[model samples]
Every structure is written in C-alpha cells, then in structure tokens.
Target: MRQGLGTQLRHLIDLLDGAVSAAYDEAGIDYRPRYTPVMRALEGGQPHTVSQIAEAAGITQPAATQTVALMIKEGLLESSPGVRDARQKVVRLSARGRDLLPQLHLCWQATRAAADSLDGDLPYPLSEALAAAIAALQHQPFGARIRKARAAITKETS
Candidate 1:
C-alpha cells in the first residue's frame, strides 16, 4: 500500500526533528525543537502575554499556553501578572534559559548549515516547497478541499 500525503509529511517532520534532537544530545544541550519558537520570542527580552507569544511564535494560543506551562515547570521560563491587566499573565525567559542561549545559538548556526547542505543535495529545497505549500493553503485550505469532495460524494450518492 502507498503512504498517504499526511503520513509522508509527518514522517519527514519526525525524521528532521529526530536529527536535530540527536545533534542537541551530542552537544549536551537540553532543548527540544518545539521550544525554539517560544524561546526565540522571549529572546528579544520583552515580557509578553500568552496571546502575544502565540502571535510571535506563529503558534496557537493554547499551544503557547501549554508550552509556557511546561517551560515554567522546567525552570526555562517565568510568568507574572500583567502590569496593566491583573487578570492576564506575561512570560519571560528565566535565568536558566538565558544561560543556555549561547550554546543554543551555536547549535542553531550548525543546524542551519546542515540544513543548507541537505537542501543543496536535494532535487528541490524542502524549505521552498514548504513555503509554497503554506502559501497555497492560505488561498485554499485543506478543510475547504475536503468539504468540496464531501459535497461531490453526497451529490453522487443522491
């Protein structure tokens, strides 16, 4: 049986993520790829709310919230009541997170170089393909495509 598009895409992501994680392990860096976006957002030295972090990280608010909670538990981030709005909370990198930045930066540089090499070896660069796919999805989302297919199926059945 042939692999589905979603399965193939997920496998590729897992492979890439595993490679990066292995590199981090070899370098003795305790970090996860998923943490990168949130860390990068806080790297600017600005305290931001969950919504702000989600926007900056290009992730959903719930995801940001969950990541923040985990980071807080891991001592990588700290949160405080929002200055203006007491009900809201703002988050920033903790001392431990700041200490890890230098190593992370070096790892990031190496990872970028490795990715560039991979892109060069491939028939088409994965980054460009991903960007194009995302752009296409923005114009016509998968949900809409599924709905159209479903409507066609219903019409045929009727």
Candidate 2:
C-alpha cells in the first residue's frame, strides 16, 4: 500500500531530524532544532519582544513564548520587561548562550552544507518544494481545502 502524504512527510522529518540531532550530539552541543529559529532571531545580541522574535522566526507567538521560557530555564536566554511596554517581555541571549554560539554556528554551517549536498542530489530541491507548499497554503489554507473536500463527500454520500 502507498503511504499517505502525512506519513511520508513525517518520515522525511524523522530522517532529517535524526541526522541533525546526531550532528549536534557529535559536536557536543546541547541544542534542539526547535531552538534554532529562536536563536537565529536573537543571534545578533539584540533584545527583542516575543512578538518580534516570533515574526522573525516565522513561528507563532505562543511557540516563541514557550521556547523562550524553556531557554530561560536552561540558562540560555535572558528575559526582561520591555522598556516601553512593561507588559511585553523582551529577551536576548544569556552569557551562557553567547558562549555556546561559536560551537553552534560551526554546527549550523556544517548542517547547511550537508543540506545543500542533499538538495543537489534530489530531482527537485526540497527547499523549493517547501517554499511552493508554503505559498500555496498561504493562498488557500489546508483547513479550507479539507472543508471543501468534506462538503463534496457529504453531498455525494447523501
């Protein structure tokens, strides 16, 4: 039997993540893939509001908030109230986080190079396919498409 789209997609993620995680282990870096986007947003040593980091990371505010909280607990990030808006939490890398950057950057570079090699081997680059998928989803969300399909099935069954 053929695999469903979601199953195939998850398998691809598992393969990629398994290798990347192994790379981090081999490099002696205590980092997770989920932290990469948040770290990228703060890598310049600038403090930013959670909303700003979320936008920069292309993730939801809740995701950024949760990641920041976890990073803070790990001693990898510092969080403070926003200067202009006291209710807003601004965050930046902690001293420990800054210290970890050199190793993390090296690992990132190696992983990126490996990804490029993998892309070159594929018939159609996965990056291009991901970009196209994101664009299409932005144009018409998957939920909307699912609802449309459900309506058609309901009508046919009735």
Q: Measured by TM-score, how close is model 1 to the native structure? A: 0.93
lDDT of 2 by residue, 56-105 (tens): 99999999989999999999999988898899898999999999999999
Show model 1 residue runs off by greater than 4 Å. 153-158
Mind sharing the TM-score for model 2? 0.94
Give the residue spans of candidate 2 off by over 4 A. Answer: none
lDDT of 2 at 62: 97
Error of 2 at 155 (Å): 3.3
| CA lDDT for candidate 2 | 0.93
Model 2 weakest lDDT span, ten residues long: 26-35
lDDT of 2 at 132: 99
- For each candidate in turn, the TM-score is 0.93, 0.94
Q: How far is candidate 1 from the true structure (C-alpha RMSD, Å)?
A: 1.4
What's the count of clashing pairs in each model shown? 0, 0
Root-mean-square deviation (CA) per prediction: 1.4, 1.2
